[model samples]
Target chain A: MKFSELKKAVAIIGIALFVVVLSGCSGGDQDQEPGEGDQAVEEGLESAAGGETCASCHTDKKKLVADLDADPPQEVEKSEESEGEG
Target chain B: MEAEDKVLVAKEFLNTVHGQQGCTSCHGGVEPAASRKEAHQGMVAEPSAQKDSKCATCHADAAGTFEMTLHKTSRGIVDLDTGVLAARINPEKADLLQKAVDNHCASCHIDQCGDCHVSRPQWSGGGLIQGHVFQETPNPILNCTACHGSRVQKEMLGQGPSDFEPKLKPSVHWVPAGMQCVECHTKEWIHGPSTEAAVRYEVKEAPRCEDCHVDDTFYDNAYHKQHAEADPGKTLLQCQVCHSQPYNNCYGCHVGKDDKGLAYFKTDKSEFDFKIGRNPLKSQDRPYDYVVVRHVPVARDTFAFYGEDLLSNFDASPTWKYATPHNIVKVAPQAESCGSCHGNEAIFLLEENVAEDEREANREVIVPKPPPKF
Candidate 1:
C-alpha cells in the first residue's frame, strides 16, 4: 500500500484498539481518578487524532474540497498584489 | 493560493516537536470550544509576529534579539529614507515618507521566524510546506528567495541568463557545486546577533569571500597576486569586479497608485549590464577603489506622488550605488585578459552612460575616463 494508505490503515487499527480498551475500562476503574488511569493516557493519545482535536478536520482531506458540500475557511479577502523589495 | 483554505495536515504532524504541545498551546482558542469558530477565536496565523511568541518561549535566545537584526528591523532602509534623505530635503515631510516606507518597503522585512522555518513568507503565498513541521534550516527557495527573488534568486540559481552576456551560465557555486545559501550564510548569520546594526554590512558575523577562499586559492593566480592586496587607505579590486557576471540594474522608480488606488513603486527600466566605478561606500573595511555599480531605482521624482519637493534634493545621493552581484564564476569575461578590462570604457560607468536627468545625481559614480591600457 502507499504510505498515506498505510498511515490510514494504522489510524483505523489505533481507533479499533481505543474502542476495545474503552470497552474493557467500562467494566471497571469506576473509582479511579481520570489522570491516573490507563484510559486517561489512552485518551491523551486519542486526542491527537480524535474527533475533538485539530487533526480531526485538518487531516481529513475530504473536509476541504471544491465540491458543493465542501466547507471553506471564513473571513478570506481578495488577495492583493504583493509590494516590497530589497 | 486558490486553495489557501485547505489546510490538509498530515497524520505524522502530531509526532513532531511542536505537535506535542497540542493546537491550543501556541494558537490560543476556546478549548473544548463552544464551536469551531470559538476554537479558533484567538488563533494567530503567524505567532512569531510577536516578540515573546510561543516560539520565543522555547527558543528564547534567538527570538529575544531578532527584532534588532537587519533582516527584522530593516533599519537601514528606513534610516535612509527618514534619516539621511530627510536631512537632504523636506525635513518637514519625513512623516509622509516614513508612512510610505512602513506600508511598502517594510512589508518584506517584517517577516518573523515562522516565515522562514514553518512556511513561506506572508508576502510570498504563505502556508505550511511540510504539514506544519518546524524546519531547523530554512528552505532556501521557499523562505530566502521568497523575498529576495528580485536579483539574488535569479543570480544564485542562474535562473536568469545575463542580458549583458547571453552566453553566461549559472554561478559555478550553484550549477556544478550545488551549494545552498546556508553553506556560507550560516544559521547565526541569518538569525543575527542582538545588535541594531544600521546596515547588513555592519553585521560582523556575515560571510566574507576570504574567510573560505584561503591564501593559496588566490596566490597562485597572477591577477590575484597583483590586485588582491587591500590596506587601510589603499583601495583594492573587489572580488565581484572580475568574478561576478553582468547583473540586473533598475532605474527610474516612481511611487504611485494603481487603478485600485493603492500605493506601489514602479521601476521604469530594468536592464542587465556590467559597470565598474569608484566606490562611494569606501572605508577601511571595504577599501575597494573600483567596484561593481548598479543603477538603483531612484529618480528625482520618486516620491512626487506623495507631495512636491519631497525628494527635492535627490541629487545629493548617487543613483548608481555600490553592489555585490552574486553571479560568481571561476573565470569571468573581465578575467579572460588584462586588455578585456583595461581601457574598457564599455565596462565602466562613463559620463555618457548616465541618463541626462540623472547625470548630476550619478556624478561621483560616473567614471570620467577608462583606465589606461594594462
Candidate 2:
C-alpha cells in the first residue's frame, strides 16, 4: 500500500472513533435525565410552601433560639397589617 | 414567632436513631447552598416518592409488600366497581362515566409509606405527626381514623350519635380494652400483597374470627365450631353475621362534580341496623351460607352528573354487599337464642323486606322462608 493511502485510512478511523464516542455520550445524557412525572412532582414540591425547607432552618438550634427570641415579634407585623387593611 | 416556628413549637419533637442519617438523606432535592431559595431547589415534599429507591434499601420487604397492599392499590376498588358499571354501558357513555370517576372517586387513594408512617395523609393536607418523627405503627386517630372516619371510625369508636337508634355502645374490643386497629389487623394483613382480593372479602389472609379465636378454643367453642366448621356444606355462617353489633347503613349515595371541578358526594339517609342476608360471594376462602351484608347506598344515578342512566343494570350487583362491620361485641342479640336469627324473619332480609329494585339482585341473599323449627 502507498504511504499516503495509509495516512488517509488512519484519519478515517480516527473520525469514526470520535463519532462513536460523541453518540455514546449523548445517549447517556438522555438516560440520566429525569422522567416527566418525577420531574413534575419534585418541581411541584420545590415551589410549594414559599420555597421553604423546614429542616434547613428549624433543625438549627442556634437559628431556632434566635427566631424564638426575635424582638417586636412576628405577630406584631401581622397585627399591624391587619389594622391597615381594616 | 413566625407561623412556621409556631408549627415547630407546637409539635412534640423527638429524634429517631434514623434521624442521624441527615434530613437530605430521606428528603432530597435541597441544594447544598445556604440560601433558603437555593437550599429548597427541586425539593421533594414527601420522601415516600423515593421509597422504592431510598427506604426500600433498608426496608425492602416492607416497601415491596406494601406496594401490593389494598391501601396502596385502593384505586383498584374504584376501578373494579366502575368497570362493572362500564361493561353495561356503551363505549362512549362508559368513557364519560370513567372520566367522572377518575376525577372524583380516585381522589381518595391511599399514599405511600411516608404519608402514613412519617406524615399525615395528603388527603388531609399533609403535615408532620409529632414533628417529623418516623412512627413504627400508625396511631389509629392520626392515620386510620383520618381516612376511615365516616364509617369504620364511627362504628369502631361509636362516634356518630345519629348512626345508632338508641345510642349504641362502642366495640367491646375498643372501649374498655383500648384495642387499636393494629392490634387485630397484623402487619401482613396491612402491608402484604393483596392481589387475591377483588373486594375486601376476597382478601386471602384477611383477619378472621378463627385467627385469634383458634379452632376448638374457648372463643371457638362448640357453638362457633358447630356453625362455622361442623356444617360441612349445609349451613355455614360468618362470625360477623351473628357476632357483630348493629352497624351504620347509608342509602342513596350520589356523586357529582361541582362547577369548580371538585368531586362532591351526598347520601339521602343513614341508619343503624343488623340484618342477616345470604352470602353474595362463596369462595373457598369464604364459604358461608349466610353473611352480614350492608347496603352501600349506591343508586343507579350515583354518578348522574357525568351521564344520564349510566347504571341501567344497577341491580346486576347487590346494593347490599358482604361487610365486616367494625362494631363487634362479646354478646350480641343474635347470640341470645337460635330464634333470634332463625325464627325472626325481620332480622333476615326477606324478599318482602327488600326494595322492589333491589329484590332481583338480593334474590339469593334474601331468605325464602323462616328457619323451620330450629
Candidate 3:
C-alpha cells in the first residue's frame, strides 16, 4: 500500500478507538449515578420507595408509628452554615 | 445535657410518614456527593429552620400550629414590659432594652421545631438525646431546662453553688414522681398559637397549682378546707402562698456595652427569700390580696450601654414584682403555723424589708403593717 494511504488508515483507527472509549466511560458513570447515595444511613432509602431499611432495627411498627404520630423525631444534622458561628 | 452524649435516633421513626422522606430531603447538602465533607457542605445544623420546606409538606397542620407557638416567636420577654423596668423606661430607652435583649436574650428563644422535638436546644450546646433516633418526648434535662436553668431547672433540681451554706430544696413534684415538664406543660401549651403576651402570667393557660391539686372532697385536707372557705370581702389566696418555699431573688441587674461595644450583663447579688406582697396585678384572674414576690435584677441603667435615661419612670412599677417561684414543697416552713403567714411581719413585704431607695417603686407590692390575724 502507498505511504499516505497507510497513514490515513491508522488515523481513522485511532479516531474510532477514541470514540468507543469515551462512550464506554460515560455509559458506566450514567449507570451508577442513581444506584447509590453518598451516606450509608441513606443507602437504598429512596424518597419514592421510602426508608424501608430503617425498619430493620425499628421492628415495632405500632410503637414506631405511635411515636411518630405523637412526637415525630425532628432530626438535626450538622450544617456548614453554622460551621464557624456557634 | 452533656456535650459528649450521642443521641440515638429511633429506627421506628423512619417507618412512619416522616421516615418516607429522604434524609437529604429534610437535611440538605448530602445528596449527589461522595465524601462526608461534601455531604455536609452548606448543611443546616438544625433542619427545623427549614420547616416550611421540610416539614410542612407532609405535616402541614402541625407545622402551621408550631409556627405560632410562643417558643417559635420567643415573645415571652416582650411582656417584660409590664414590669417596672419597661414601664418606667422612656420609649426610646425601652427600644434600646429591646435591642439589648434581641442581641443577648433573644437568641435563647425558639427558632425551629428541632430545637424541642429533634435535638437538645442549641443554646445548651446541641447534642443528641438518642443515637440519631426520633424521640416522641424530649429529654427534660437536655431539652426543657437547659435553657430554663436560671429559674425553673435550678430551683426544681435543688442545685446550688458550692459555697451555698444550705443546699436549696428541689420541687416536691419532681423527686418522687419523676414528672417531666411536658406532663404539666403539655404539647397544647408548647404548640399553642402565640398570644403576644409578654409574661407567663398573661398567658391564660399558664400552668396552675390548682390544675393538679383539684378541689375535690377526695383530695381535700385540713389545709384545703381552711383555705378553700372563701371570704366574701377578702381577696382569694394563691396556692403558692403556703406551698412555695423561698427561691432565688436577683436584684440590681445592669446591662452595659463594653468599650469594644459588646453587650454584657452584671447583677448586684442573688439571694433566696420569700416575701408576701400585695399583687401588683390585681385583675380578676389574679384576685389574691397577697402574692409571693421575688426581686428581679432589672435597673434603670440596665441598658446604659445603649442610651441614657433608659428607664426614667423606674418608680412607675414595683421593684419587687409578683412572681411564681418554681420551688414548691407540699409543706413549707410557714404552712405548718398560722402565724407564719398571718400577722407575720417578716413574711410580708413590709417597708423594712426592701432597700431604702426601692421603697417608692415597691410600694404597690408592700403589704400593710397591720397584718390580718388568723
Q: What interface root-mean-square deviation (Å) does model 2 yield?
A: 15.8
Weakest 10 consecutive residues of candidate 1 chain B by summed lDDT: B80-89
TM-score for each model: 0.82, 0.75, 0.74
Off by over 4 Å in 3: A1-86, B1-20, B51-53, B79-85, B161-167, B218-220, B259-261, B370-374
The residue-level lDDT of candidate 2 at A86 comes to 6
Top candidate on lDDT is: 1
Candidate 3 residue-wise lDDT, B262-353, digit = tens: 55566777777778888898887777777888887776676676778767777887878788877788778777787766776778888999
Model 1 lDDT per residue over A1-86, tens place: 89999999999999999999998997676766545454433443345433445555555556445421454555434224423343
Pick by lDDT: 2 or 3, better one: 2
User: For model 2, how does the per-residue alpha-carbon lDDT over B179-218 read when each residue is reduced to its tens digit?
Assistant: 8788778777888887776555556777777777754465
Rank list by lDDT: 1, 2, 3
Error of 3 at B372 (Å): 6.4
Ranking by TM-score: 1, 2, 3
- Give the worst 10-residue stretch by lDDT in candidate 1 chain A: A76-85
Worst 10 residues of 3 chain B by lDDT: B1-10
Report the Cα lDDT for residue B111, model 2: 66
In angstroms, how far off is A57's CA in candidate 2?
Answer: 3.9
Candidate 1: regions farther than 4 A off: A1-51, A66-86, B1-6, B31-35, B80-89, B161-164, B193-196, B231-235
